[model samples]
Target: MTTKPYFLLCFVVGLSNPVDAMYYVQPWMLAVIIPLAGIREGQQLLHELYLLKKKSYAHINYHIGMFGSSALLAFALEFSEFLLVSSTSSLTLSVSGIFKEVVMLYLAVEYNNNQLNTLNIVGLVICLTGIIFHCILKFHALQKEKPVNTDLVVTERLLLRRMESADEWSVDGDSNTRRTSLDD
Candidate 1:
């Protein structure tokens, strides 16, 4: 049977904003979800390993070290992604991911002597334009929502304003604020 339909369903589910928000609210769900996913993936890995007829382990220690490093890196990557999603919206993460891919594509073209046709260039330009627009819209929205501290003293050299504590800044669903002082 074809797996396209299942892949499409998963893609649609992944793009659901409500589901993403729900996951954000209940991040503990990862404890359950990740294990289930790992089990499924581990089964697939075992099947593939079994299919291999000749498997030689000359440098078992080196392979074990590499596997350990790979696991650590994967954990670090997931942790960083969780923190990024917490600090910014999922849309921001998606846009940044696409931009990263575009950069990688360009780097490959430059360093690996990969050729890009007109269509590839056009696609890259469109992706870049969309990312730029998204960034501009997000910046303007943030600027409009940001509370300006009216308590200001205009000096000759510097424009100073009262620094609000993290608690005050984090009100009204703004969890992006970080504690700046020990007093906070």
Candidate 2:
């Protein structure tokens, strides 16, 4: 088979395999992926470290530290994403969530993957629709938006307004304080 078809078949199978493992395997055992991930990341980190050490580039130490920190953060996020995908009941939903994430990354980086065939375009649309629908449903849950309090007046004006008009009226009706200035 061609590479694209093979990749698509493997992707579908990978998505399916996770579903079975998610249901039958213990949650704690799913953590095995983390250490395996660490091994993979560790290899990449070593490569970066080697490059940083060998190159007589400016800010070598800074690059090394940054690479280390980013690898650490990537590890955490990878584990978290795995947990999310495993906990989700539907493989399609989880895959779509990942698809949306990739689209967001593409938008943020302005990188063209250039594999945008009709099917990829259709999948992107479905992923975007799912993400938007999920966001809308979540927003709808908070039918009444809560007021936010902040020290900055100008920036938080909208929040203040929300607070002021939160309910029909205050139950106390803006009563005066019982304590006088002398009480202090």
Candidate 3:
């Protein structure tokens, strides 16, 4: 619920993934990384495209609504991915996903007042089937993977997975909290 707990889960999940290693960048690097990520989010490019569309199309309000919805969708996707990765179990992620789909469907019907015809019903069925298959595959894959050894040195190494980019030295703190940087 709190960031402290989420961060602790992040550390655990990061170490648990065998295929992908999660690296914690130095705290000082946040200054540059955060701004760089913000700049690269394509807001300016999206704005320019929207302006071009507005000039070419007669329905300016339509363009505005589309762009606004797109921005909201992007934000939603980013936040959902962050939560999904931070969550401890597949069940939590699956439930949250189902809740999201249900909310979206409700909003669509409420806003448009469109009837769910046979085609729409088929689409919904297919989508639900895909979601079920995805969950099953994910759980199966997780079960097949070898469990990681969460030793003091191993976790410390995992935490500082990509420490070569940072110019710092590993200091002795607690065994679990150690970090190895390029200097070491």
Number of the top-ranking candidate, with lDDT as the measure: 3
TM-score of each: 0.39, 0.30, 0.41
Off by over 4 Å in 1: 1-51, 58-74, 88-99, 110-114, 147-184
Root-mean-square deviation per candidate: 15.6, 18.2, 12.1
lDDT of each: 0.60, 0.57, 0.64
- Ranking according to TM-score, highest score first: 3, 1, 2
lDDT of 1: 0.60
Cα displacement (angstroms), candidate 1, residue 47, comes to: 11
Number of clashing residue pairs, candidate 1:
0
- The segments of candidate 2 whose C-alpha lies over 4 angstroms from its true place after superposition are 1-39, 52-103, 106-120, 139-141, 144-184
Any idea what lDDT model 3 has?
0.64
RMSD of 2: 18.2
lDDT of 3 by residue, 1-184 (tens): 5543545555556544322322342344567876886789769767866777554665666868998998688656655555565545655577678777888888888997867889988999898888988888878888899977565445556667656434343445654334455434
RMSD of 1: 15.6
Residue-wise C-alpha lDDT for candidate 2, range 4-39, written one tens digit per residue: 343234344443343443344445655887788777
Q: How does model 2 fare in lDDT?
A: 0.57
